[model samples]
Target: MKVIHVGVGGFGKQWVRVLRSSRKVRVVALVDVSEPALAAAREAGGYNGRVPCFTSLQEALRAVPADALVCSTPPDFHREQVVAALRAGLHAVSEKPMANTLADCKAMLRAARETGNTYVVSQNYRYRPEMWTIAELVRKGGIGAIGQVRIDFHKGVAFGGFRAEMEYPLLIDMSIHHFDLIRFVTGLDPVSVQGTAWNPAWSHYKGDCSSSVVFELSNGCRVVYDASWCAQGDYCDWNGNWQIEGTKGTILYRNGEIRLLKVGPRYKVESSETMAPKPPPADSQHFVLADFMRAVKNGRRPKTDVYDNIKSVAMVFAAVKAVKTGRKVAVLDKDSR
Candidate 1:
């Protein structure tokens, strides 16, 4: 499959490298506003001297005959680029958060539907082996009807200036991944959410530094999530700690370990086991690209298809709305405009 990638930023460069490494894909083009980044990507190989680098999407699209487009652009530009790719008769795989608003997501989905091309949102957290193992256990009834889920992604890094300057805050920029992961594991849609956010340590950033959200899913399961870009501590890292509790057992995933605790009459003592650590088959960017290529080749829907991902995007928006209005927000209906 021939693919063209947009953005070429820190994450975009990773996408290019992974796509080049994949046996199923050829990186045909690279697009970015930054000349330096494009230059660096060109020197990284696979394109050799033939890979066309463009400072604009229009210019790149005109030159590259791509079967698929990978969007690693910032949140604001996702909608326009995704719509453009779909309109250009190519399937699109977008980085997380889909877009900044429900309107943009709706428009992008509509375009993909009209074009009859697949549009995937790259929520790679779902593909992590640890999370997949936990999901499997949950699905197999090892967890026996989930009761509650708690997810926390905290980091001490200040995000420098890129995230600090955004108006949408950390939840919109980062929490979408965790929210989508919850949906992936539980296979339940969040019906309503309530959240609170604050800029505790005061930064130049316009949005809040820390946020906590509570959600009620359609299946009567409750989920609580906490995320912060301004967390301060020595041991704090980015992986995010997660715990899921069910009637039969509880799953705890932190650092790199997946632990399960089950209680039963036969075994009065709680049983515990630590899952073996396995590096992601390929980095998430590579896995997502591979999945997209497979879908393109076989004419199948990607696991993170637009129709399926729009809900996760909606949940992010709902959390943002909940934080702003200080009230519970209902997720937007899929059929509703």
Candidate 2:
């Protein structure tokens, strides 16, 4: 696939790295608001200067022939940039959050529909081995019916720029990853969400860096999300610690380990077995790009395609509303205003 890559800095650099390593992909053009960022991307990705650089995506699209446009811009830019690509007869692969708001996501989705072009949002966490394993177990009825899910996502880090300044940083910036995983692992759509966010007295961020978000799923399964970005001590891994309980069994995934246990009559463990995560065919962004490329080639919608991803984006906003209003907020859908 020939591609035009936008936003060549920060997470965008990682995307450039993945594109560079994929033999199936040829980056036809680079687009960034910063000329220095474009130069840095070429240097870091070992790209020859022959790959044309452009400060404007419009110019890049006209100058280069491409099969798809890879958009890694900030959330606020996603709607316009992705819509432009779709209108230009190019499939779009976008960074997560889809956009800063659900309304923007809908606009992008509308563009994809009107243009008849595939638009997929990159949701790399859904491709994890643990997530796949959990999905399989639920599909196979290893867990009769999901009842509840608990997640503890505590971390201490400082990634400056947009994240530090954003209000509800933990909920907006990080919790969406966990929220998407909840939707994927259970195969259940979120029905509603309620949550709260706060900043610790000694926290560095201007925004609240701690939060507890609760999601009520389609199957009446409740997912309680307890996460903190300004936490101290005993930091959980990025995937966080998960305990998914169902009618018959429970799956405990902490750090990188997975354990499945059968439930007895009175909530006692009837049996226990430890299982290693089966490796996914492709890892992280590699898997994401591979899926996107295949979808573009096949003229099919990719996994986490705009429509499917909108629900996850909605989950984030619903929680945001919940935090702000102090009430349960219903998750909206494609037809929502």
Q: Please report the candidate that would top TM-score against the real structure.
A: 2
Full-model lDDT, candidate 2: 0.87
Show where candidate 1 strays beyond 4 Å: 234-237, 265-269, 277-283
Please write out the lDDT profile of model 1 over residues 264-306, one tens digit for every residue.
Answer: 7654637898877455565566677777777878989888888
Q: What is the lDDT of residue 194 in candidate 1?
A: 96
- Which pairs clash inside model 1? none
Q: Write the per-residue lDDT of candidate 2 for residues 1-337, one digit (tens) a residue.
A: 8999999998999999999999998899999999889999999878877799999999998888888999998877888899988988898898887887777878888898798889888889877788777778877888789999999999998768888888777776677788888888888889998988888997989988888988899888899999998898899888999999999999998888889999988998989998878757998888999998888778777888887887888888899899899999998754542
lDDT of 2 at 39: 91
Candidate 2: segments with Cα more than 4 A from true spot: 334-337
**TM-scores for every candidate against the unseen true structure:** 0.94, 0.96
Clashes of each: 0, 0
* Model 1: worst 10 consecutive residues (lDDT sum): 230-239
In model 1, state the lDDT of residue 36: 88
Q: List the residue pairs that clash in candidate 2.
A: none
